[model samples]
Target chain A: MAHSSETLNPFENLRLELRRGCLVLAVLAELRSEQYGYTLRKALAEHGMAIDEGTLYPLLRRLENQGLLVSEWREEDKRNKRFYRLSPDGKLILKQLLAEWQSMNASLNGIF
Target chain B: MELLDRYLQAVKFWLPKAQKQDIIAELSEDICSQIEEKETELGRKLNEAEVEAILKQLGRPLLVANRYLPQQYLIGPVLFPIYRFVLKIVGLCYLVPWVLVWIGLMTFGLSDRAQHPSGSLIGALASLWGPLWLAAFFAFGVVTIVFAILERSQAKSRFLEDWDPRKLPPVRDPNQISRASSIFELAANTVFCMWWVGIRSPIIVLGQSAARITLAPAWRYFFWGFLFLAFANIATSGVNLLRPHWTRARASVRLVTDVIGVALFCWLCKAGILVEISIPTVAPAKTLEIANAINLWMSRSFPIVFIVGVVIAALDVHRIVRVKTADTRPLRGVAAAGGLPQQ
Candidate 1:
């Protein structure tokens, strides 16, 4: 079976490189309210950014590791689930990133 | 459910040791939610095949596990361009010279060791290939290891930051002649011209033997012509040392001199018995035999010399084209720096 990162076509590889940065902003934006792994994937997919289960789990771990996100295991529906939310640092960084994104988008529109 | 248990176990086996139980617990929760969602739609629990399909969608156990760990490679993208440059440096500066020396040894040195059968030169060359490839492989391995360590350490950025563009060597021009080489050629040609002028009899005594070798009377036709070509060569070399560039005038002079030199070689080549033994009075046949043997070596060497002269003349023709192109090329830096008068 092909692995998650294996043999993406040329267009797919480029699309992935373009999407990698946006996914971080998207995750931080959605984690404003607390959500667990499955629900977060469902929410992102509902909002037109379907992430792979493999890709989402590790990205959450990395963000938590970097102090941009915080996670805690809590009991729900008789089984334990890891819940995640953006940290205060994440909120500050996200605001800066959104401003940067808007300025860049306006510059690109001017060029176009 | 059993298949799901086995799938989670496979993934857990490859996860980082400290985080295995925690990651597996979260992954198990996600998979359970997925299966529960599917069962609600189907109005029953998922079969074994359905469980396998869901696990396949998550991806390979190792790949899913690997994403949580830090990225690893022998050389990462940042240092890869420099890695390629180092490899080319190894090829040009290291491997090429070693291969050339091996070729030189086979041609000049080892040929002497191989007794006179020219075919043995090829055999001697074949024997060295194994060792040459082994040395190249060893060099490649060492460069890769050094680059790998640099990629992983903090020193990569420091090495890049410390580089000075000003210290790079100046760009080389192909048409420019080396002053040192021109000087050496001029000196050697001057000595040759002097030796040619001092020889009155044109006689070559073979050591203390009475078997003296004398130039045939036919050589008298080419002596003055040969001396004139030598003087012309010396003049060209002298001019090159001062200017150090392949100007059209210098190339023309060298071409004309080479044409005349080649004419002399072709003219002398026709003078069939160019050398003869002056004293073989006792046996006329033996005298002819010894002279034939000496002339045989001469016959083999002159064609190689003739071909080399032709090739040099061809190169001078190319140099003339280069000189014309160099004339047309704009002096950009000189113009920008206000070194040239305003147009």
Candidate 2:
């Protein structure tokens, strides 16, 4: 069991790298509908794409920094919450990326 | 609410000053929502243990805060390998030598302390270690600062990209110059230079009170030459240790030193053993005959020594030019595994 765990480590690391690219795509795709951090995390988790709060928050900020997403703070449930949504640029990129993702998926399917 | 506030405060302490309030507010709202969701599921307000579990799940305050911070590196990934390389060289050149010097000082002190039982070995070690550690830290700081500047400027990555794979050192062969052998040569040469420098007279004592042969003044004249040869060997070895791939460079350096060594031997041969022997008044004539015979032997052996020196130098030159060319014949796929023997 310990040996299997040890061997799993490298695969786990590579899996994280694989998930990293997918996470950005998922976040961008979800934010097209506009949602706050907690709701966005919940929405993604419901769809079997669970992301940690730590990873989700930082990635949101980074995407915003890159001008692919825009964010605003507004009062919701008697408390101020920061809401994020895809920008015009992000929507354009999402379209292109989705196409790329589909093509890659198709190619992978053929191989498998 | 109180538990949530304390957790937020803990996290805020680690966040950047400019973003502290904004980040804390966002984080507080997220935690409250999570706790509310958990409470709805369990149908009760969370206890202290549940709150603690929630906070642990969020991760350590410092790590959570760090995720929000911009990625920072003193040496970025692009330049990290080179930075590590430079540090290793500095460690080899500075730290190793300093530690060796410290050990030498400690050995000398211990020997002295052997004479006087009251003397403290620990005190001697403490004194040397303090200064050596300070110097090592200073060197480390200087190298880090230099690399940090290079990183900030992004100048080194540009230089690194210009590197050619063809210039990569061939795979090392067992018989070729190695780090251990180079270090050994460097250390031996250093000790020889130190010994030569400290010598008041190069004396050869033959048995007990039989005869004492002191080298002539001509040996004194060649002190600088011998010292230079030793220093050259030391330097060549040092370079080889850092950049073992530069086989041609190592060969050239060895060739120059070998020529100098051969020249020094030729000078010694011309100077005729450079010695004066003194014998006791008892059996003075016989002792003088013995001394004359010894001198005659030295004169006869000089040519053989000179021939050997020439042969060694010639061999180094052949290895550098001919063997290197022969080995490089296959080119691309097959890199030469061996190099000239660096002795």
Candidate 3:
């Protein structure tokens, strides 16, 4: 017998929910260093947090729309590219998020 | 490359009109970058099959575009439960009653209605169908629209959050009757009592007797008995409202009252000539015949009241037995435990 793609695991659903919030935090942290869409994706993949392009692009646009990030279309490597970087608000938000994350991590470590 | 362009075009078609071009262009540039990296790895240009693999990994065009749109619903999640509740009430109060009455008329009223040209069973059912369907549709549509508007209005308001859990109704035991149903019964009994008192004289007067009928003189005697039963029902409803639970004593009272009611209605059924229609203008024989016809109608209806009363009385008996069994079971458990050694 073989497992098929249609087979669902409850653990996978829960893990996806856990990862969703982390992905937003990871994207904001990465945008501290300016990068184009492809390089940012490659960089995140290198760090072992692999987000698909569909989710990544929509999330980028959403974050930019919320004024946490800014983007510009410019010539890079002789091709038109949209570069993204953190805004002033993005830095402040990132600091708050990281503090919350660290406090939760410490508390979880203590409990475990 | 052509296949890639077509995929991007398909994705763009689903994207918002304002950002479609910009999104597609950015997506195209990213795909081209990935293809170039892959080619560099392979040490050669990639074929169509290789490109298609990359596209499949990226995701289907519709799914990718859908992610860009915010979630949408006719009635949003916040208002959905309330909307469902309102529909259920409509079903219970309006639709269920309508269906029951339709069934009753089909079962009983068909022969009486057959004198009319359009009163065949199928025709009567079809006539009911049109109104029932239209009424249900309109009821649902109106409720949906109201909730959709409410959803929009409450989206930014604290209407949901402002509610306190303490203000919510307390949980009740399954054995206990709901206060709402008890209140409804109380109101209904009160109405019946009032109608029983006032309807007699008006019915005898020909100014507005629809059936031109009169209750038999025996009903004048039967009235006090029926009114006693009505008061008993009202008293039980009040008891439930105050106590909000059933006990053996309460169940016994209900059982006794229902048995008395069944007896009273049975006495009324045996009472002579329950309905009369006297028309002085008509011939005396015709008047008696008219009176007999109404009497026949009343007699036909008597068995229904008897059956309903008997069912009510039987249910009360069942309830009383149940309460007794329930009362004894816990005590029996306690006694058994007392006999055992302490742990």
RMSD of each: 7.9, 12.5, 7.8
Local accuracy of candidate 2 as per-residue lDDT tens digits, B1-343: 6777788888899898988998888888898899899999999999988988999999888889999998888888898888889989999777866665554445543444454443676666556667877988999899999989988888545766677899998765433556788889989998998888776466766678776777777776577788888888888888878866446667778888898888787677657654556777547567567767776666555555665675688778886875477456564433333333332
lDDT scores for all predictions?
0.81, 0.79, 0.80
Assess the local accuracy of residue B266 in candidate 3 as a C-alpha lDDT between 0 and 100: 61
Query: Comparing to the true complex, what docking class would candidate 2 get?
Result: medium
Q: How well is each residue in B191-214 modelled by candidate 1, as lDDT tens digits? A: 988887765455766556565667
Expressed as tens digits, the lDDT of each residue in B1-343 for candidate 3 is: 9989989999999999999988998898899999999999999999999999999988889988998888777787778888999999998777766765564555465454475468777766667777889989998999999998888778868487788789997543345777998999899999999988875552455565334556766666677877888899999999999887778888999899878888876676556443556565666678778767765665455645565675588778888887777667554454455642211
lDDT of 3: 0.80
Worst 10 residues of 1 chain B by lDDT: B110-119
Model 3 chain B worst lDDT run, 10 consecutive residues: B334-343
Candidate 2 segments whose C-alpha is farther than 4 A from its true place: A1-8, B108-123, B155-333, B336-343
**What would the TM-scores of all predictions be?**
0.63, 0.62, 0.69
Query: Each candidate's fnat, in order?
Result: 0.89, 0.79, 0.79
Interface RMSD for each predicted structure: 0.6, 0.7, 0.9
What is the docking quality class of candidate 3? medium
Across residues A37-91, which tens digit of lDDT does each residue of candidate 2 receive? 9999999999889998999998998899899999899998898999999999999
**By descending lDDT, how would the candidates be arranged?**
1, 3, 2
